[model samples]
Target: MKFTDGYWLMRPGFTARYATEVADVRAEADRMTLYAPVKHVVSRGGTLNSPLLTVECWSPAEGVIGVRTTHHAGSVRRGPEFALPGAEQGAGVGKVRRDGEVVELVAGDLALRVDTAQPWKLEFTAGGQVLTSVGERGTGFVTDPAGRHHMLGQLGLGVGELVYGLGERFTPFIRNGQVVDIWQADGGTTSEQAYKNIPFHLTNRGYGVFVNHPGKVSYEVGSESVGQVQFSVEDQTLEYFVVYGPTPKEILRRYTALTGRPALPPAWALGLWLTTSFTTDYDEATVNRFVGGMADRGIPLSVFHFDCFWMRGYQWSDFCWDGETFPDPEGMLARLKEQGLKICLWINPYIAQKSALFEEGRQAGYLVRRPDGSVWQWDLWQPGMALVDFTNPAATAWYIDKLRQLLGQGVDCFKTDFGERIPTEVVWHDGSDPERMHNYYTHLYNRAVFELLEQERGEGEAMLFARSATAGGQQYPVHWGGDCESHFNAMAESLRGGLSLGLSGFGFWSHDIGGFEGTPTPAVFKRWVQFGLLSSHSRLHGSKSYRVPWDYGEEAVEVTREFTLLKHRLAPYLQRAAQQAHATGIPVMRAMVLEFPEDPAAATLDRQYLLGEDLLVAPVFTDDGTVEYYVPEGTWTNLLTGAQLTGPRWIREQHGFHTLPLLARPDSVIPLGADDQHPVSAWADGVELRVHAFADGAERTVEIPRSDGPGRTAAFHLRREGGVVRVTTDSPHAWQLRIGGPDGVLHSYPAGTSEAELRYES
Candidate 1:
């Protein structure tokens, strides 16, 4: 996508034109139109050649500005636009101020300035400080060899400006010096390609730019020019939105308000999930053994996922249980559910020729077709597989009927997989352009199943362990990191992908605990156990192998049990965090930069992340069980070891299999459930409000939402003055209180108590 040869020359057979001056301007209520010819018209004789580039600017919602530049206004635009929230443009209202040859449109806290005189420029400012600007030669109309017409825009990159969130990238957490293409692909965890490529990026400078195109967007982040973040899109118009954060959290809030926030997944979906891994020989006996083994070890396994083998081989996505492997699926699912487990079966939007549904789909015109009106079939992962044409309503209904049968068999969730393998050289049912539908197919594919789940099971009960997503796919609940190798490097790569996805507005994300491509070593398995249990969603899945903890070693099972129980205890806090995400569009598992935007040290720290704003989880990525992590300015308390440490510094330590560095920030109140029997939907019987180190006037609120009804909620303050400490809460729920850091317990309050007001004086 790069056409510039070094800094000054253009590549052969390619030429781009830039506007040097705006010749005329027209102003409306909330929008401004500028007609800028490629060259300045010095006189009436000079206005004789080339097309005028039409650039229009406006504000959509508060703190957001949109700019659309076009070389040809007659170009046709197809369907399948992003599913943005219906907010009126300039909902917060804005004003136009004209001064000399400069016109400015100022929205709430954000202003877009345009110059009609010499050196045409477009600048975006927040609160009077310029964030980024489109300086000289920043806009170009490109003409390349293939006759492709593209509009490119370049924004100034300030010193130390690091960009993040082009969607689940595994290359590097800081997206500088990288050429990122916003196109969804089936590429795994090791490649520069991503499964979910959102065309939005947030910088450490408190601003974000979202390319308003569903098609592929080419981004050269400090790569092409080395001084600007340049983005280009094919066609006549380049439309983008500049959203002002003023802070990262507010940036996400406004962004998701424009797009959508994740629906709160069901409580059961938040707990530990054990899967019968892909290509593993699993029948009724094997599933029972794995499920029973976890129970025998007192491990709370919430969801049991049956991978691809659930359907007969070569007949992928038949939506029927393999008769040979699972003869009695109904009775089998009932028995597993009797053991307090939810069922999730893997399904994709493909119908193999060998499948029983293939003939039906092909005959009913429910599959994608070629130009010759023949079903577009491929033999990549499945033999002669044809994609389900979700663009057709009847085809979607036919697919839904097949899934409804699985729900009848007690499948509580669906692992909507393989939407990334969608082909672009085909004809869609609704006549949607194949190129545009390539990435947006996942949204439709998952939406069909997610809506069906909501129809069957009531609202707030639908959950999907989806693998592929694009922009606005956050409306679906949970997505996991796709295939990864079984190693420390792959573990870190998965975390980077999840953190990047979180920055892209996804609320819940997970990954395979012990990796997905192969079996993990015992040390790696146990370490990933702690890390997985800390994610927003936890699951044990892999390819060509089983992910049971016992398969690694007894130590793996012990570590799994310990962390699973700890996660179960942390469910109250986790669920509240999820609710906050649903409300505010912030992620449950956030990157440190999201919580600590002021700390430049946190902008690149991908190995460690903050789990729900209070606890810092640094997963050990070495065989020696040592980790190096950064803590922002604070008096932090280690949650696992009860040791208090002062930071704004880096700490490196080695540990054993049972422990990782789990720390709690100062002045935080962490809630723990009393029992680990049922990790989902169970009310806290004897809740323990673990209060960490605090200063006077520091208060914390804990809100626990229940499935059956409104759950118990509490807020308390911690104050230490004149050699005395006091704690207070207005909660009516019965709970105990514990005071201390990780080093040792200060005191434990009696159970069945609602409030504990104690004074400590020396």
Candidate 2:
């Protein structure tokens, strides 16, 4: 990805042609085209031998500008492309202005300015302030010694500007000096490879850039040019969109609007999930023991998952339960559902040779084939495994029919895994470019299954525990961090990945509770239990060993119970957060920098995150429970204990296994549900509007959405005047008013009483 040897020279075997001054400009109603020769044209003969790059600029939506630079206009188009649902709306109405030497296109508050008389430069501005610019030699077409072509573009980065979000990167939270490739791989948490590789990055300077390439996009963030983010693709053209937002949250909102907004997962999917870990020997009896164990310990569990090995060995994706392990699949699922537990089954898109459906897929031309017309088979995860041709609608229908059969037997959702291992030498059924389909195959694979689930279940009720994704993959509700080691370092790395993914337009993310590679130590297990239960979706999963808390220690069981109960109690607040994710693209678990973009202190802090808009969570990563976290400027109150701390500073504290730093921001009202046994309940039945450090004249209206269905919501209004806090609601159910301060106090009101007041000393 890096092209320069140093500041003054290019690396060997590389030749580059840069776009010079613009020769001519053609302005249209919705777009503008710039014709630039690679050399400055003082005479007509100067444009004869050199390449003339064609640059086209337009707006997809308000505040988003798309620029495409091409060397050749006759290249064949590819089949697989990102689905931009918002493009059809045509919200970006452009007004073009042609001054003496400058041509400008204004869309909403954002504008693109080009000076035809100067060297090729494209400057993006908002409110007359430059956000970023493409300067001299910024747009390039390069060729190596092998005669392969590449198109690249570089955007300027200001001093002290920080870059984040290239799709679930675990390397470092700040991607300033890293060489990142937007290629999907199955490498675990410790490697530079990522499962979800989105070629989008937002900076601290109030703008984001999304490379509209689905295949391989190589990025050098502040590394190639030392002052710009350079992205290149091995193609004849390069297209990217620059989105302007004065705030990080707004940037994500605009970005997701262009791609697709994340679907709202059901409320029950937000609760604690217990999974039969991968490679572990689990049968009906083992599942019963784990389910009964959690119930006996008073731990709230909402979903029970069965990982791989549910099918017979070497027969993955058969969609049939192994009769020996699960003799009666329907009966087992029915009994588990009777106990109020939803069911999830592990599945992937690959069909092994031993599977019963493999022959059907191969015979029907539903499997990817090599150039010689043979099925592309591999022996990596499973023996003689072939990928399902999702590009073929018949293949997708065949695959969905298998899963539909399982859904008929009472399976609620699926853990769609291993779409990252697609092969590039194979041919897609729809004649998509093979190199492009390597990363894009997951999108089709997940979309087919997700749409099927939406048809079977309702719209908001469909969810997937998907692992691999691309730019538009946020349409699926929930995604988890892939394989991680059972250790403190891996735990912190997982948080970094989640924060990065959240910034990349994903709304909900989760991880393995105690890691996936090894059996965690007691301290690791207990600490991870607290962290995982606080995530957007919590699941206890591992590889060789079971993730039952009792296997670690009795303290682990207690820690798991405490956090699971706390998550249920926090469901009202979390559900609203999830709704925000559905409406906008703001993630449920937000990075500290995303929430506090003005605070330089929060730019690189990835160990901690904001659980929602109100609560800040700093997961304990040490064995002794010692954690150091930064709190933005506020008088934050701990939601766990009645403790207050003034921040704009760092706080170091040692917590027990049962607690970590979960603080509510000042001047926030958190809706606390009364039920601790289940996430799906009447959230407004006996809720508590916990008011935290309201200002003298602060006013807030909180809407609590019901779990039963849409359109059933409870509204509560609160206003603080002098020393009195008055609360009023339009709900028929009883509720309480809790004021948070140094001494937390609670006051209750009857169901028929619609108004209440509490006097407190300021």
Quantify all predictions' global Cα lDDT against the true fold: 0.86, 0.92
Q: Which stretches in model 1 have alpha-carbon errors above 4 Å? A: 86-92, 681-684, 706-712, 717-725, 742-755, 760-762
How do all models score by TM-score? 0.97, 0.99
Q: What TM-score, to 2 decimals, does candidate 2 have?
A: 0.99
| lDDT string, candidate 2, 1-762, tens digits | 877788888889999999988999999988899998888898878868789999999988888899999999999988688889977686447777889999998888889999998888999999999999999879979998788899999999998999999999999899999999999999999999999999999999999999999999999998888899999999999999999898999999999999999999989998999999999888999999999999998888899999998999999989989999999999999999999999999999999999988999999999999999999999998899999999999999999999999999999999999899889998888999988998999999899989999999988789999999999999996899999999999999999999999999999999999999988999999999999999999999999999999999899989999899889988988998999999999999999988999899999999999998989999999988799999889788888885888889999999999779999898888888999889978999889888887888989888898856695788899999999988888988899888884356677888877888889443
Clashes by residue pair, model 1: 641-742, 642-742, 642-743, 643-742, 643-743
Please provide, for model 1 over 1-762, each residue's C-alpha lDDT reduced to its tens digit, 9 standing for 90 to 100. Answer: 787999989899888899778889998877888888888788987788777888888887878888889988887777678877835444536677899988998878999988676677898998779999997778768899988888999999999898999899999999999999988888999999998989999999989988888878999999989989999988788988888998988889988888888888987776789999998899999999999999898888999999999889999988888888899999999999998899999999999999989999998999999999999998998999999999999999999999998899899999999898677789888888788888899999999999999999988899899988888899987899999999999999999999999999899999998999988899999999999999999999989888998889888888988898898888888998988888899999899999999888888999999999899999999999888999888788888878777889999899898988888888787888876666764444467767777666566666655444644455555565544556565544556656665434445654335455655321
Clashes of each: 5, 0
| Top candidate (TM-score) | 2
Q: Considering every candidate listed, which one attains the maximal lDDT?
A: 2
Residue 596: error of model 1 in Å? Answer: 1.1
